[model samples]
Target: MNIAQLSGRGVEITDPLREYVDEKLSRLDRFHDQITSARVTLTVRDVKNAARRNRVEVQINVPNGIIRAEESNADMYAAIDKASDVLERQLRKFKTKFLKQRHEAQPQPEPGPAEQAAQLGEEDGEVQPEIVRQKRFELRPMTPQDAVFQMEALGHDFYVFKNMGTDSCGVVYRRKDGHYGLIEPK
Candidate 1:
């Protein structure tokens, strides 16, 4: 397993704390051996309220995609524990989905038309409903701030727009904390 990069914001990282984080994250290798890299950030928010002051965020890069988990608590150690638990659950889910997709992608014997249709409607042993509606819109070029404004005007949680700076597709969304987040291609 690759050693994770650990950083702190508004707090000093001690040797014991670093060792604890390394020991906790190392166990993730049992779930997926292909974890390319991991980044862990510990933050201590300077807020008046002491509850949920410490935050732990972990981002793991794998072959298929990235898995992330964030948790906050009054104690940094508790926050780290919660974040690791969330990561474990997400890694298990990702592994199961990857295995299922690999199994489904294998060559199969030709089936009758009805059987093919049935198979198309069922994936992972669950029936999938067809699309009932569709919408088309122009992706106007705008800055992330403008996209966030447009999303709020349209009463949408997310909006896809062409980024003015990068000249590429981007997404702006409202986070649960009433802040905005932007997503762009690497």
Candidate 2:
């Protein structure tokens, strides 16, 4: 497991903390050996609620997707532990689905027209649904803060916009706890 990046925000990371984080994250390799890289961010926010001030965010890159978990607590160690637990569960779930897909029976050769008709006429056959609606809109480049405002103005749970800083696509969404979260490609 390559720890691609580890940084702190609004707080300096001490050697002990860094080592602790590395130890915790290294154990994740047992859950998903395909983890290509991992990025960790430790942040200390000056918020009124001390219990929600310290935050730990972990992003792990796998073969086809990224697994992310964020947790906050009064103590940074506690936050890291919670985030690691979340990542462990997500990785297990991902591995299960991946193995299921990999072990499924392979598709057979195309059936002849008569066989196709017979299969289609089966009484218990199921049909795939088609898209029922589509919409197109212009994506404006803006800051994440602006995107959050736009999302709220439109009464939407999420908004997508081009991040002006990185010049990349980003999404800002409202979390269940009323806080906003941003998603950007690495």
Candidate 3:
């Protein structure tokens, strides 16, 4: 597997720095060999408060999908280590889950498109209705001011609620530029 490390936000990027990152991320393949490549990015925050805001983000590419993990620390090396650790665990979890699902399906040998289509047509003779397997409980009657507070508390881009005074289903969402948008039933 190949590992590429890149530094952004005017940070110094050198071969030795990237080599260090590659060595840390390469350890993940010890647990899950299916990883094809990893891309790590380092960026320094422009905030004036503290150096802790510097961040490291890592992305691992697998056959099925990509996995991303990130962490911010006072030092760039610490941030990279923390993010790499999280990525390793996530890779193991995904690999185990995918193998278990494949084993349960007992899929047959690969076949040509014609044979596959015939099998699919036969299987489609039986129809099954889908059911809602999960239900999410969200929000409560509150003033718009309070609803906005709740939305930020949940760290979500949007929130749903019954406006206390209006007694109607409403939504408050965060915009890309840190603005709030309200949706009220007409």
Candidate 4:
């Protein structure tokens, strides 16, 4: 895989560090051969807190989706190792889910025309919401259960995915009560 090492504030991407990251990340090919590229970023935060200054972030782009992991430690190498380990676990989880879905055969009924009507109506107010930042990524299709797994794996509060069971887009989010909630189109 093509690995790019980026040096963030107060950090330098030396040849040795780049080689080490390349070596560690190359092992990920065994899990998924479709990994297109990997980006490793090194950052040194707050000089006063030396024990957690060295930070490493790894982003791996694969054919289906992207996997990202970050870790901070006293040493840069240690941070890289920790992030790599986390990334490996995520990859394994993703692979396992994909395999299970591929081998499973389930039948789902399609939504009727009346049942698939638009759920949200346009508001008459002139107010418009501001969107400061936007992110674009592949929306992998999976079940709500799988979306919850994906959200927790990424340590994110919510995850958006295409619901294969309904053949529609859905969002799985962590509720305030530590439970899961799923939103889908009517």
Q: Pick the candidate with the highest lDDT.
A: 4
How much lDDT does candidate 1 score?
0.74
Q: Please, what are the lDDT tens digits per residue for candidate 3 over residues 31-68?
A: 77877777777887766775547788777766544577
Q: Go through the candidates in order and give each one's C-alpha lDDT.
A: 0.74, 0.76, 0.67, 0.77
Model 2 gets an lDDT of: 0.76
Worst 10 contiguous positions by lDDT, candidate 4? 111-120
- Identify the runs in model 1 with alpha carbons over 4 angstroms from their true place: 106-186
Clashing pairs in 3: none
lDDT of 1 by residue, 1-186 (tens): 575688999888999999888888988999999999999999999777655499998878776356778899889998889988888887887787667757774433222221122322346646676899997756776666556655654457878887776788777777657876666665
Worst 10 residues of 3 by lDDT: 111-120
Each prediction's TM-score versus the true structure: 0.57, 0.57, 0.54, 0.72
**Rank ordering of all candidates by lDDT, starting from the highest:** 4, 2, 1, 3
Between candidates 1 and 3, the one scoring higher on lDDT is 1
Off by over 4 Å in 4: 4-7, 47-52, 106-142, 164-169, 176-179
Give the C-alpha lDDT of model 3: 0.67
